[model samples]
Target chain A: MQTPASFEYERATSVEGAIASLQRLGSGARIIAGGHSLLPMMKLRLANPEHLIDINDLAELSYIREQGDELSIGALTRHVELEKSELLARHFPLFRDAENVIADPVVRNRGTIGGSLCQADAAEDLSAVCSAVKAKAVIRGAGGERVVGMEDFHIGPYVTAVGEGEMLTEVRIPLRPGGGSAHEKVERRAGDWAIAAASAAVWIEGGKIADVGVALGAVGPTTIHLSRAEELLRGKAPSEGLFAQAGEIASADCSPSADGRGPIDYKRHLASVLTTRALSRATARALHQEA
Target chain B: MHVSISVNGEQVSREIEPRQLLVHFIRETPDLTGTHWGCDTSNCGACVVQMDGQPVKSCTILAAMCEGHEIRTVESLEVDGQLDPIQMGFHEQHALQCGFCTPGMLMTARALLDENPNPTDLEIRTAISGGICRCTGYKNIVSAVRWAAEYEAAAKQEV
Candidate 1:
């Protein structure tokens, strides 16, 4: 029947109330946002939490705002919102790129950013997208709010820094000048997970790359952050050769295993090509040459 | 757990387990088998239903979480023997051969036309990307949605 194991469910009225419930219930308590990612896992019996804290009622948490030096996206924001957010498109088009390819519109309607990040599936798109944008995860708990980088936010596959009682409240993408980001993914079908996806962001200043972030999905145990490629791209002039070089670095850094998606060699090749494509597109956008 | 959800247009309360999926709840409560339960995973949109005006895969949603929300199933598409334009369009275009994916496709198309009244062929295809139709190769299904859009638009213009 593919039904989840019996558990208790309650709607959370506020973030504080949700935290309190988690505190009371301890580690066995989990929050249900859109249930697109979580419920499927639950039905498969991969996730058997004793309590599900329904956060759909927490309307105050759904928002996308540009405040101070960063763009703050609330955790409750859905995939459809990200796909349609003009503000996000203006700053980081990679979000729209990833959202369009995340899943079908029906699943996107109910899935939330918080839930996708918390699910932390290695093959998932958003984790790599967030990492390529250098976004910060805002985790709320009894100790108030703590912001952690994507590197630390994701501890491993299906594992995150969100502790027993902590809930991810928002993701903050730093507003960097001359920055453009793109996500390149090749899935087997319309809504399937990527065989290997690459997300790349480049910031150009004085015709040279000021900073860059590149990450890959479905190729490693966790979202593979190409720190070596990022370091290699900094302060370099944007060019096809440089991007290809960075792609080579990305191909070598990612640790992929063979499965239905492809052989290990094919995945590494896809990763390299996608990295180059993303970097080329990102560079074009940063230089304002995108059509 | 006791959950009260407005199904179609009626407020029906039912006692359901926390893990009970919404598809099962609807089928068992109102006896609306029109919403087919295919792929218990969210991959198949056969269980697509409107939750407060948006189409969502009911298989992945817990009925307990649907409390106080409005759910619209395919059973509500026909009113007093007058079929919804989407259903009629499907019939007219021969959109279904096996009929397993019709309900989900119809509901998904309903939501698409609601948000985007005049969806292009590409848009229609994108909207129903979650739905899998093993028959007609989706050419007829796409035409069916387009026909509904035209039908609804014409009806609006006449009004």
Candidate 2:
């Protein structure tokens, strides 16, 4: 296992206390929420830090609530709970569907939504889904608190817009009336990371598309939002022609690397196929709800 | 740093290095070797333990972070020398060969059945996905968990 050169761990009871401890630890300090992604990467010596400021005790960061027309999910909510949440299922069944494709039950129990977003792994299912859903991340730091769009949160592989000494506290997703969504991914196995994935959500108003979002995963440095594809389907009735065109656009837009998992061309092909499948499934759900 | 936590129905407090992992601390400090170390990393659930009644990879958590928490390892699965049903099921099914993975397997099974006594085949597969067993193709392992679930259910119904 990879061992840190040297490090310190502080268990902070409050958000302010955690921020203060992080400031004291200085440049090499990083907050550890669930540690599902960070600890594994640390063990591989891929990313090493000098200190880990534990923030699991901040119980305030583990809630899922409906506020007005949006759903605010705390960063510390475990994937298992997210999957089992009756409220999320009632309002946003997409999230529950997305949670099913995550790593595994053990990982779902330990992995936090914030940890996954902050890690910004291209192969991550939730990060891609967040972008497709246009979720906003609430981040807190020494300076203050601010909301960042999911598309802007990711800078590149293993990187995010979360600045130094900042922590993502919660994710805010807008609730659309009469909307439907789906997330689908192609993976080597049940518990393995996705080779490619897609998430699609559409808002149906008066038998026409009011909004559509499509995001791709594991095919680039970061998840790609197909704005051009979404634009093609906006205000149009759901149809195979539009989805197929968007799928083609998504395949063309992705810039995946050839790794041990598969060839670059294969991943690109899978991206198109999965995107098409996801959009098709999402569109059917939308129509079904309307009927 | 000094840390105090409950383990297997008992309270334990000790001073440990800040960098010590919970798994290492449990094995070295408290001398509870029941939680085996297969892959010192979190991929292999061999170091799995119950923290506050939820299954977590002990190797990933820092010992200092476990202060004031409740921890339960595979060693606590028995009652007065009577093996836990999961353990007995493993024995009856011959679920282990080298036995390196038994402790972790038993702990994972206990946690799964605790939450879901009657898990579907898919749920059972997902529950044990984090754990790795180089021995027997997991056929007997799955059978053992299913058997324990049935055994526990039947016992509950009798009472």
Candidate 3:
């Protein structure tokens, strides 16, 4: 039987209360939102925090809304909500696409977006989706709040910009005009982690690509933000040829190690193929050619 | 720590370690052994239960986190010895082989039907995608959920 080591549990009623407890408990404390990722790690003895500050009761931190020009998603928002949010679907269908394939419905009901991002697993789909959408992380500490871009939010494997005495409060994706996003993943079976997944977002203006974001998951230590591919796609007209070239970049760029999912060559091949598919679908949606 | 949780509409309180998982708590505290504990990694759905009316894998949830929440186990599906329509459907459709995956499958399907009275075959398959049934190859399980949906719809019309 697998079980976590004995630890003190504290339930936080408010965000401030949770932060205060985090500060007091210092590095020994960990904030558990959905407990899906954290509890599993705890059971394996991979994560052994001395104290767990439960934030599940902070209902105030659960929301997804349009705040001015950006979409603000509360950190405590569950995966089920992300998958079902029509507002999100209207803006970024990639969320729903990725959520559909990320684990199963029952797990989605209990898993939170905040926890998923914080877990910082390389195979996690949301990190790639967030990176592709240029989402910003809003981290709250006792001093104040600081916003970090997706590139900086993830520092290493299973590591994030969320400091020891802080917590991720919200994720803000800048709403740009003429933008469409899609996520594509290939997994071995239902509810399995991606062998290689790609998330692409394209903003078109006057039949030309104004801006683009492309990222790959499960093919690297952290989300592989395809800056080279984005640079190549920028200012170029959307075409099969341009996307094919971008796929080549993805194949050459990602750093994947062989494991149960696939070998290095297979994952690299998937990275390329999935990136092209995502880019094609995203562009089609941007031109209002596809739903 | 002392944890108090509502299991099948009954409040059960017990003194346990903070790290005790909900699956063990449900079985050992209220002695509701119907909720099986399968994969400790949360991959297997044998440990599924309803928390606040939504299905969650009990093996990964700490009992301490469920202190104030309402948890419904497989034992609740049969009240006054009258099986839930889902159970009846399972029996009629022969949805079980080893019976190990039945409890979790029933709870997961029950939650899905509660939220969606009539789900398509694709929807039923998607709803129970988390569960792994080594027996029956899921053909009869899908039929069982469909049968339950039809049964409930017919019952509603008769009423």
Highest lDDT model number: 3
Q: Is candidate 1 or 2 superior in DockQ? A: 1
Model 3 Cα displacement at A47 (Å)? 0.6
- Tens-digit lDDT track of model 2 for A89-165: 76666688789878767767788999999999888888888988889999898888999998889888888888777
Q: What TM-score does model 1 achieve against the real structure? A: 0.99
| Candidates in order: C-alpha RMSD to true structure | 0.8, 1.9, 0.7
State TM-scores per candidate: 0.99, 0.95, 0.99
Question: What is the docking quality class of candidate 1?
Answer: high
Mind giving the per-residue lDDT tens digits that candidate 3 earns over B46-77? Answer: 99999999999999899999988999999999
Best by DockQ: 1
Residue ranges of candidate 3 with Cα displaced over 4 Å: none
Cα error of candidate 3 at position B89, Å: 0.5
Candidate 3 docking classification = high
Q: Write the per-residue lDDT of candidate 1 for residues B1-159, one digit (tens) a residue.
A: 888889998987887888899999998974788999999989889999999999999999989888889999999999999999999999999999999998899999999999999999999999999999887899999999999999999999999
The lDDT for every candidate, in the order shown, is 0.93, 0.84, 0.96
Report the TM-score measured on chain A for model 1. Answer: 0.99
Q: What is candidate 1's CA lDDT for residue B124?
A: 96
**Residue pairs that clash (backbone atoms under 3 angstroms), model 3:** none
Q: What is the C-alpha lDDT profile of model 3 across A39-90, one tens digit per residue?
A: 9899889999999999999998899999999999999999999999999999
